[model samples]
Target: MTGGVPEGPGDDRWGSDGGWDDGSLDATARVVDADSSEEERRIEAALRPRRLTDFPGQQRVRDQLGLVLEAARRRQAPPDHVLLSGPPGLGKTTLAMIIAAELEQPIRITSGPAIQHAGDLAAVLSSMSEGEVLFLDEIHRMSRPAEEMLYLAMEDFRVDVIVGKGPGATAIPLELPPFTVVGATTRSGLLPAPLRDRFGFTGHLDFYSTEDLVKILTRNATLLEIEADPAGVEQIASRSRGTPRIANRLLRRVRDWAQVHGRHVVDLPAAEAALDLFDVDARGLDRLDRAVLEALCQRFGGGPVGLSTLAVAVGEEPDTVETVAEPFLVREGFMVRTPRGRAASPLAWQHLGLTPPQGSPGAGAGSQDTLPLSGDVGRFSG
Candidate 1:
């Protein structure tokens, strides 16, 4: 027996830390990286509509983008560098890919975080061929150095490479190949003003309408070969938070339910059952969402609660609760943002199975007490 833990005869040549013993560490690293890359590729590919025609929703954006791309192609020039801003899962990435496809150009994808230094961006830009689309996702997060380099690259098609250190350094103006840059960001507000002004075109993506989401769900269901009732599709669409990604995900879950329950097609019942299992309520509020409403109703008496206070009550980041959960609630008339803070609408109280408190200050007055707050209602009444 060996003095230390025996490594077995064949394992003696390798180090004790499992380095090279079986190449496990290397294999593990490669596997993890490969899996991550594969996932990214899958997302990029799945959400990428093969052509503008396959893209189901955002009709206005589609029409406007079609014109821009066509004009660029007719003129035989690279399309204008575009900026897309929107909430996540609203098809910003898809539109970027569509722009490249429509322009018949190769798109080199990178993110703000990937360009750690000016040199990093210079390397990527310098390597590009003519007419390439450089997609910088989350461009707002890019380092200051990289962003400064981008200003010159976007405006002049050139970069000044500084060589050597300190006193010995000299900037060599290097001409770059002409390319279009498409930047996508969830927070366009965070992008520096100078950088913001550099893009030739900016597209603001908004949440899809229930009708658009219905169309998206039906199209995806047809493609996936799942038989879904129109009513089922509509139900799923209404609950999807006006996002195609969420709509598609809901459709798939309902399809799974149909399959497991031996139903030949997904009907309204199946859709309801699936959504119930997923904890998406009739108004599409999930558990976390319900918790927020419940807190506002029961704890704060339907609340003029601040966002930070609400987030603390729900145990979530204020931003996440605001951006992700609150939008749907607001859209559905379950909540309203007040000058004071956030307050639950009458519908919100109803949804939470709670009676609207008597004489709640923000509750619209003179309407039948039973009536939920309507868009036309005044902010306050005597």
Candidate 2:
């Protein structure tokens, strides 16, 4: 808003290397897309950890959640309404399922967008059985009316059913059975204060470590009945963009390559070939990601270029470049968003194998070593 400049993932869909930050650019890697397709989602469901013990990463969240669930179980009552927030593909849905399983309760799956009104949310909440877990995904996207209704339901285990409209309307209080609400969101900040406070526990999921991703891939390979070498699995892990979903997807894709090429097992070569075919590089940078980087390093001479111009240089829409490619590029330290526009970082120059010219931005010129063409440059904390 200051002189038409963007700040804090507000107005521009990008935060100032703080909120909504972290290396998750989170979209169109396709292979590493945060969003999922129906088939991909189906496969992901089959591969998800059914219990907390089986969940590979987020050790802190897992342990904390285990204590909470165990305490609730000991008390012989439904646990508090839980909130899981993080970048997509970090197993929020899987954890929700695990919570239900731990409680030995049935889970009713629904999303925020699905409940458009107070009545809609009330209908879903009122019919729930005692000890049931209502898993609300994309919890931040719920309509305000539904969210308000949820506040009362979560606090009092009751909902008010309106009999009529306006002046003639009668509020009939409906008592809901003891139940738990497990809400998952990628954007927790969008949630209102009242809605957020209603949740007893909030677990923020982070990107998986490479070792954790490796363990996940190995387990998934066995589940898929794919013979995979350690080296091959490691290769996949290294390129998974620090996300388990991406690792598993890459493993399955590599399995397909092995099956097609008559290889009995997924080896390093098979993994490499499959990844190459998909245009996902060693760093899990797909064509679009790399294209953005290439356009910056090569076309724009390491940039100071506008987002729109960068998008056009790659024959893509600006939003695509902004949301899909640029976030990853900036987050990975390969690019930076500057006052002037976008600029490549020193890492980008190094990754592209191009020389950062003397006296130009991102060339590591002068005394300071880091070069991002901005006053503040680092991965997002979110």
What is the C-alpha lDDT profile of model 2 across 1-382, one tens digit per residue? 3311223456443345332121111111112134767677567667878899999999999999999999999999998899999987789888988998899876666677767888778766755678878888888988998888888899998998999998999999999888998999988899999999989999999888889988999999998888999999999999988887778878989998999989979999999999999988988799899888888888877777887788889999987887677756766777777667787877777787888777566677422354444455432211
Writing each residue's lDDT as its tens digit, candidate 1 over 55-122 gives 87777778888888899999998878899998888988778777877887666666787678888787
lDDT of model number 2: 0.79
TM-score of each: 0.82, 0.84
Residue 247, candidate 2: C-alpha displacement in angstroms:
0.8
CA-lDDT, candidates in order = 0.77, 0.79
Q: Given candidate 2, what's the lDDT at residue 185?
A: 93
Off by over 4 Å in 2: 1-42, 317-319, 365-382
Kindly report which residue stretches of model 1 are placed more than 4 angstroms away from their true locations once superposed: 1-47, 361-382
By summed lDDT, which 10 consecutive residues of candidate 2 come out lowest? 23-32
Alpha carbon deviation, residue 23, candidate 1 (Å): 24
